[model samples]
Target: MKKFTSIKLAIAAACLAASSAQADTILGLYAGAQYWQVEPEGQFGSSDDQQAAFNYDDDAQGSFYVALEHPVPLIPNIKIRQTQLEVAGSQNMSFNFNGTAFDGKVSTEADLSNTDLTLYYEVLDNGLASLDFGVTVKSLDGEIMVMDDDGTSEMQELTGYVPMGYLAAQVGLPLTGLSLYGDVSVLSIGDHSLTDYQAGIAYAFVDNIAVDISAQLGYRSFKLELDDLDGIHSDLEFSGAYAGLEVHF
Candidate 1:
């Protein structure tokens, strides 16, 4: 009778451990917000030769994301992110912006705010590292307004959807609440291309049984090269440092 009771108790313990492990992989939610201080570079116009250079100063922008993960077989996780970016500058040059000719001192304002929807699968998620790869569809809905000294202005609309490839990876230090991570999305089709990437270090300040909070500092760069996708032909870039907080549950 003693031998039979010991066997039953061991089986129950094993079942309990298995149940706990399965629960850990069932669901997860992550949310984060970032503040980016970026410096603008490059020019915009109807062509490479007739472009107006931007005299932009450093600007601050905001971005945020929410992601949901599940362990369901054959199903991928989803993340939605929104980014805010805009800059204004003045230059004394001759340029043709979308068939409108501008001379003398002209002020230009460009807004490049966009939203991203990503569907990814977690390929590897061990204790020390993780990797995720998938597809991202970015929606850009902004405009460019240029005004000359005569108060005449031209508005060029920038509205389009771009598809890109996404990949992310992270490496964690054992017994330390620190990690290094990077992610990127890229696309190149014909004469137009877009690339956005970030590399950063994160430290977990709060580690709980059901939640984790982390602070991340990193560098982010975004480059956009277009061939009249929205009646605007331009090459532009915004690159700089960013800081953010993340919460995972």
Candidate 2:
């Protein structure tokens, strides 16, 4: 009788342990690369010495990000997702005077980069559809260089904080271990605002390794403050493509 009671108690304890493991939360980590481009629009300058036209070009910018997500018990089939990104790049700008390029180097190079941190609640699981709504805090730090016709130059560095809110949604469909997804985000920084949209597809070959290809379209309009140059301001617009990989554990 004593042996039977001990055996029953051990079985009950094992079942309880298994149930606890099933209720434990799981976390996911994602890291990837991004390509970015920038183009400016709108007018710059006040009355005298004012110009309405400008030209600019961007090669390809690189960026990266990490995200964390977990399920919410109050809302069935819903989770919360948060992410942060670091981006950097350079661009060339030129000013045109009545179809003649200015003898002076009106062009500038910018080492503009920023980090974005966001928190949002996501709904829909089962790998079919998901929606996220949240707010983002941005920290920007960079320098812009302006050159003169005689090849002389000066540098201006800017560092500040900005806040913005965003919403993102994604839908997935599977075909031969591959899935397609789409996302969009809108941000407001000072007097400037931007809307970014992207669509992509990923292939999962083994379980922990995956390859993704995505294209991005963006629209932006912002005002900037500059020193040493009177009546200085800017309006920018850009779009591009990106491809990267993800590892899950």
Candidate 3:
């Protein structure tokens, strides 16, 4: 079993390397990575009517994406992007969370960590501009543990998947190595609403026939509001600045 698995992995790696070693052309590949310094705010509760004031120190988030483009007509190019979200803080409550009642004087730490996976396609690509559209599935797979100074504790598990609309666009600046780009993934369905957006500028540093490398700086914001889904209800917002690197293969 181990030998078979290793053989499969080696084959996959060889194929990826062979494709990436070629020069950029009608069929090209690319990958990107970025990190953000996020500031989070707002409150969360077990029920919609019960919320606690929430605050946290600055947190860091990381994102990555890889894409494949081919000359096939009517078939969209595919890209996959993933991002990590994590935060921890202590706040006094306005009501109850995880069945622990508080009169606005109890101090407890809360951790809400999540990840978003986006699978999108290139709707339009050209020399002047490009656009992509698809769907993103946000996996809210984390937990919140609350405890007072007396060691009294409670745990509320947060786990769910939300499908959202994804769209992105990029515009090149004439007579320069700079470009502007923006991305959004949002939706309002049933009792939940989620929105994530980012806008940034990119500067190509090394562009040649074989490879291209670029630097990027941007700002991003995300909001998640839930209403009694999986016994969790809250409004959370994260906004911050980011820096990134992009490579064409």
What are the per-residue Cα lDDT tens digits for candidate 1 across 1-249? Answer: 999999999999899777755666788889999999999988888766677787987899999999999999788899999999998898888777877888899999999999999999999999689999999999999999998999889998899899999999999988889999999999999989999999999999998656789999999999999887877777899999999999988
Write one digit per residue (lDDT tens) for candidate 3, span 1-249.
999999999999888766654434467888999998999888778877777765577888888888887766667666666777767677655456767765544554444555666666776777789998888887777776666655667777878888889999999998799999999999898878889899999999997657899999999998888887778787988899999999986
User: Which candidate's lDDT is highest?
Assistant: 1
Model 2 lDDT tens row, 24-91: 34444455555444443333323224443334454455556666665655432222222222222222
**Local distance difference test scores for all models:** 0.91, 0.49, 0.79
Error of 2 at 98 (Å): 22
Better of 1 and 2 by lDDT: 1
Query: Which ranking of candidates, highest TM-score first?
Result: 1, 3, 2
lDDT of 1 at 197: 93
Q: TM-score per candidate, in order? A: 0.91, 0.61, 0.82
Q: Looking at candidate 3, what is the lDDT of residue 245?
A: 97
Model 3 steric clash pairs = none
Query: Which 10-residue window of candidate 3 scores lowest in summed lDDT?
Result: 104-113
What are the C-alpha RMSDs, in order, of all predicted structures? 3.7, 8.4, 10.6
